[model samples]
Target: MANPVLLNNIDHKDLHVQTGRGAMFGDNVMSALTFPSEFRDIQACYPIVFRKADDGNFEAHALFGFQEGENLFLGMHGWEAPYVPLTIERQPFLIGTNGTELMVHVDLENPRISSSDGERVFLPHGGTTEYLERVNSTLLAIHQGLQQSRGFMAALLEYHLLESFAFDIELDDGSQYRLAGFYTINEERLSALAGAVLERLNRAGYLQPIYMVIAAMSNFRTLIERKNRVHAAQC
Candidate 1:
């Protein structure tokens, strides 16, 4: 546990705490563009391992709940599945994150093929589209669930509930692709997004305790976005 470092409350810049112990939850987590080498190789387990580690998949819906909880407790719930290993099984790929956004880099022996799970794998501008299509469908399900969920009061509340998720797909041969998981609730930047949500929910007279948090996250998201965008532009 990296010495179980005591990260203070102030240390929480955006309250993005991952729950899994070894691979999923670690201090080594960095921007999607980069990952530690140890995580980049998996001669045995492939897509299944990578899928579970990625917090953006439908299999990972509870990840947001895990994040909200980890905002308070360092230990978020570890995602588990039958084929999934308790330990993060490397799958010839790397998964990186920020807030609700995600990125995945796949390292394949073959230069021209794209694949997921145990499929035969295909090439760029090909079956990769299927994976992307599925991600879109999954997100639609999430949004539909959000729309139909019980507690929503207004568009503001609904928008605030939306989380940003992006994917960067890379192959071993340096071939790459990307897909947007969810459109930000509004084209507006983070501050505008949070403020609109909080004001709407507060006026609605619901989730007061949660509103206090929404207020904090409002500023946090803005700051993180500014920092990340600047860093990305630099890179």
Candidate 2:
């Protein structure tokens, strides 16, 4: 459970947050929410896919492993991937709404937070620290990106461009894991789109991310290699 509270200099002046990657820091995630704004970087490392929400809406995710709580990118050292998703990077801090204003909220229960070590939340003089400034930027980016993604996903759904896929992955040791319930772009549908429809998607700025999601499937092979290395090490 999260004990989120509005961040303030008086209450959180001495607060600090550890920025490290490990299971201890709650970094053992199979996937993280992603948006079109981050597709370029996310596509380079993770397989970008879509999943149907409980509300029947679609959302994008950057897959890290085949099962829940299994992050192949995590190791004894740190996150193996070059790009960490913004959703993961924004841990322990979140944007809270005060009427129409966005305020920063801190999760008191998060393991990353402390008062004696790591990056400080505020300066002694009651101003934001550099670390907090970066957090603010990350939160803002997430806010904007998520808002844009809703419409982008809606368009994809409207055009029937999203398709579900399942994969039975075999490791070097012959262990098999079947991945399911994830969605990807239907390249055939996209390619068959009418010129006018393509123009509309292009004008809406959804084309690039669409292609990026397709390109990200290539990283599945990389993920398989990482999974193989993990399995071999445990053997």
Candidate 3:
């Protein structure tokens, strides 16, 4: 469970966050929630898929692995990919809105949270540290990206562009895993879209990301290779 609290210089002046990636620090995720704004970078390294939220609403994500608590990108050397999702980049920090103002909240239970070492949250003079400033900017981007994602998802739903799909993987060890309950854009429907509809999507700034999602499906092969490498090493 997360113990989140509004960050304050007075209470957290000495707080520090350890920077790095690993499962112990909560990096062992099969997927990370992502927004259309990040499609380009995410597509370069991950398969962008859709998953149903608790309310049955569709949300986009960048898949990292096939099983629960698995992240093929994570290895003894750290994240293997050149691009890490912002959703993963923002660790131990979350955005909260105090009225109209956005505020940063820290998760106290996170392993990255420290006091004696790592990146400091505040300077010796009680001013915001550069590390905290970067975190603030990242939180703001995540907040805004999520807000825009809602409209993007709504448009996909309105056009009935989403389709349920499954992934059946046969590893080198002759073992198979069936991944289900996920969604993806229907390429047939996308290609059949009327010119006017395409133009509307383009004007809304969702067309490119839709294509990015499709292109990202190719990364499934990349994931399989990574998984095979890990399996081989274990063997």
Best by lDDT: 2
lDDT of 3 by residue, 165-215 (tens): 999999899978888989999999999999999999999999999999999
**lDDT sort, best first:** 2, 3, 1
- Provide the lowest-lDDT 10-residue window in model 2: 74-83
lDDT of 1 by residue, 142-185 (tens): 34433332343233344554445454534334444443443222
Q: What TM-score does model 2 achieve against the real structure?
A: 0.98
Residue 88 alpha-carbon offset, candidate 1, angstroms: 18
Residue 232 CA error for candidate 2 (Å)? Answer: 0.7
TM-score of each: 0.21, 0.98, 0.98
Query: Candidate 1: what lDDT?
Result: 0.30
Q: List the residue pairs that clash in candidate 1.
A: 114-122
Instruction: Give the whole-model CA lDDT for all candidates, comma-separated.
Output: 0.30, 0.94, 0.92
TM-score winner, 1 or 3 = 3
Name model 1 segments beyond 4 Å from true. 1-148, 157-166, 171-177, 185-190, 193-197, 203-235
- In Å, residue 164's CA in model 1 sits off its true spot by 8.5
Better of 1 and 2 by lDDT: 2
